[model samples]
Target: MVTGGFVVDLNKPLVSQVGHLGEAYEEWVHRPIVTKESPRFFASDVLEFLTLTVWWAVPLIWLPVVCWFVSTAVQMGFPSRQVAVTMVCGIFVWTLLEYSLHRFLFHIKTKTYWGNTMHYLLHGCHHKHPMDGLRLVFPPAATLILLMAFWSLVKLLTPPSVARAFVGGGLLGYIMYDCTHYYLHHGKPTKGISSNLKRSHMNHHFRIQDKGFGITSSFWDKVFGTLPPTNPAEKSR
Candidate 1:
């Protein structure tokens, strides 16, 4: 079915329909379509709008949840030092999670109908339309679901107070990540780390999708040996 000028067949795998869209699967997925608005995902306007989010909404929605987590840990009699340390550890854990999810799940190849449809809805849409400002960040509806799952996992593995602190830190890390991701797509950072990060992410979107999966930093890409080639000539090939 066509929605917002993009074709999607719910009964057939998206990969199989690429030729009909007039591009090879790889080329169509990697070639960015510049647009100010996001494409429709649901027939219902309300449901479709729920999938599109502005970059600013990330902090506005999650900041209070982070504060609540940290404060609850403090109220549970965890020492300030312990709470602080656990929170930092949580942030560190988020970095690794970010890298792994991007490389493994978001970029996973699938040919089944549901697999391709879900993949397109989740991440492929962003790759196919890299500059769609409305879709640059994760929508709160999707994020809340993942946050609940991770919260349960953290709480299960750690003491109550520690879990709260850690989750708070991880949530902060996510906030930074989403904001950084949106900025990388739209902000002009001519120098320093921001510039480097923007270049790395742009390469991931336009040049090499399999490499440079780390959105917030390239540190993990370096650790995993997935960093994209630095030479412009090599990238162009």
Candidate 2:
């Protein structure tokens, strides 16, 4: 099916549609489509709108939730030091989780029609249209669902106070990620860490999708041996 000029077959695997050998598929999928607006995803206007999220909405919607988690942890008699420690740990954990999900789930090769469709909706579309501002950040509706699952998992593994603080920190990390991602795409970072991050992420989108999966920090990519080539000559090659 073609939606907003992008062809997507919901009934067949992407590999089959592009080429059986997968070489053509790789080139096609990695090629970027720059556009200001996001493509239509659902026929229903509301559903399509729900899929398009502005970068600011991420922090606006989730910041309060993070505050609530931290405040609640304090109310529950958790010491400030413990709360701080857990929250920091949560933020640290999010960086790893970010790297894992980007490298594993988002980039997973799929063979079935449903699998391909899900992958496209989840991450492929972003790759195919890397400059679509509306699609840079995760939509609030989908994020809320994931948030619940993460909350449940964390709660099960830890006490309530700890979970709350940890989740809060994770949420903060997510906020930084979304904002940084948007800025990397649209904002000019002429120097320092922001500049380096923008270059690394842009290379991931335009040069090598398999490497530099870390958005907030390239430390994980360095640790995992997935850091993209840094040599100017290598990058050109």
Candidate 3:
């Protein structure tokens, strides 16, 4: 009964209240959307897929480039292992953010003033649109501001090389998170880890809806006690 493109809960039976779109729209926001066999991504929907691709890839790759520049500056013409280590560390840091942010920010039902506003602006907007195409990834302006803040923190506490490396790693984690999220929601895999992730994410969208917030991994869900129950409210989608 969805109309004007809205997210629907698949776990629940279709009711008149749920308008426009169906469960699939909300569940797989990043995929080439189609309820009844739209064109394949490369063939018919190439333009849409390409836009989403560049949306996530640019920032993910840009972090490393920025890091390289910062690292060189911080090195002061010196070669050391710190730069390498920072790069490695930086990437891992992103994974943490992926797990944490997805769990805490995206899934939570904000109850407070600021929390609710932030939720709506950030994750809620996605839930609402889910397929606007341009809104899938974080805005570049927002990304730049975040990076600037991180860079300032790095400069204050760590060497430029180390900071850049750490930031680079974080960017990778974000890239993985964004790309993997998009794939899980849309691009179906033949099988393997990607498939597994897809299933987990699907469950999050269609089955539980309120739990299994972790996208890349469920490590934090368990830690934070947000993991879905074995027998979740079945009418969840």
lDDT for each of the candidates?
A: 0.83, 0.82, 0.56
User: Model 3 over residues 35-90: C-alpha lDDT tens digits?
Assistant: 32222222335433442334565556575665575466466643556656666676
Clashes of 2: 0
Over the stretch 1-237, how does candidate 2's per-residue lDDT look in tens digits? 443344656444342343222323344556677877566666666767777888999999999999999999999999999999999999999999999999999998864556656777788778877989998999998888878988999999999999999999999999999999999999998999999999999888887788899999999999988988987456532
* Error at 181, model 3, angstroms: 1.9
Looking at model 2, residue 7 earns an lDDT score of: 65
- TM-score for candidate 1, please give it: 0.88
Query: TM-score for each prediction?
Result: 0.88, 0.87, 0.63
- For candidate 3, report its TM-score: 0.63
Q: Sort the predicted structures by TM-score, highest score first.
A: 1, 2, 3
Q: How are the candidates ranked when ordered by lDDT, highest leading? A: 1, 2, 3
C-alpha RMSD by candidate, in order: 4.3, 4.4, 8.2
Name the 10 consecutive residues with the lowest summed lDDT in model 1. Answer: 18-27
